[model samples]
Target: MFHLLDIKKHDDGISFDQTVDVKAQLLARDPDIIDVDSVHVVGNISFDSGLYLLNYDLTYRLVLPSSRSMEPVAFDNQLFISEVFIEEQDVASKKELVEDDLVLILEGDSVNLEDSVVDNILLNIPLRVLTEAELENEDLPSGESWSVLTEDQYQALQEEKKVENNPFSALNGLFED
Candidate 1:
């Protein structure tokens, strides 16, 4: 279960804690997703120095029996306390909720950390759910292959290859004494 606590008013700021059932929420919201095994979430919200910070960590496992080409997705990530800002108005009305800023920070090795950590676990959801057989089958070419090079390394290699094959190399050789 995944839960988010509502912000409570305090002299300097607000603080709260909550736990939510993610699988049930997802199932209720979107019937297309099925076979959710379990979900666990824990976090806290605190306000300080005119800023509101929400820190949360989550771990979940899902079953995608419908998918035929991919693996069943499981994930874990942490949301760090980063920044906080306030929005004076929302699309619904002109009234403001709080006077402080709200900022969220997320750090992890998996993709969609920002979404999971900031977006309240909505964006981290797998686009396509897969079953056990789908996950085990090696013949399926569904997901992207992992890469080894950093951006800098890739750029450097490209530059080196270009210089080695440059057409001007022939001109330089012709001019050689």
Candidate 2:
């Protein structure tokens, strides 16, 4: 929990350089994300007369399921998150939310950075993660009736299919025959 007192005391804002743990919270947010080792945040909180801003860099590691192989893949990600907090009173007074006006509304004086931290981490995770060995091995799962294609083989097949499915190919075939 980030203390509200610091920002309240310092007009210029307060600086924070510390690490926090929210492993349980992370799992609850995303089931695919597991084993959240640690979260290191370095930044501060400041507020102008209009809005309060939280700017920080989030560094954390978690295990994610590889999009292809469905195996566990670990990622150490560094992300920069900048978010503005709006009080309920401001929204009631304002007309509408505009583009580039995304905000986190505060329930009270103190704000919990954990949710924001996890959100950025999740958004920045790669859609696919392949180990160096996976790339080099060129191994694919094969069954009695079907086989999985490697990245290279899949692209080659797509190119071949495009040529075979050409619209004028039937005329070209008749002439050849």
Best by TM-score: 2
Supply the global lDDT for candidate 1. 0.45
Alpha-carbon runs more than 4 Å astray in model 2: 3-6, 92-100, 138-140, 148-159, 162-177
lDDT of each: 0.45, 0.76
lDDT of 2: 0.76
- True-vs-predicted CA distance for residue 93, candidate 1, Å: 18
Model 2, span 38-125: residue lDDT tens: 6999998887654678999888887887666777878787888888877667765443542346766678877687777777776787
What does candidate 2 score in Cα RMSD to the true structure?
Answer: 3.4
The sequence of per-residue lDDT tens digits that candidate 1 reaches over residues 31-126 is: 655445434445544544433444555555555434444444444444343334322223123223332222322222112223343244455555
What's the distance in Å from true for residue 72, model 2? 2.6
Taking all chains together, each candidate's TM-score versus the true structure is 0.41, 0.77
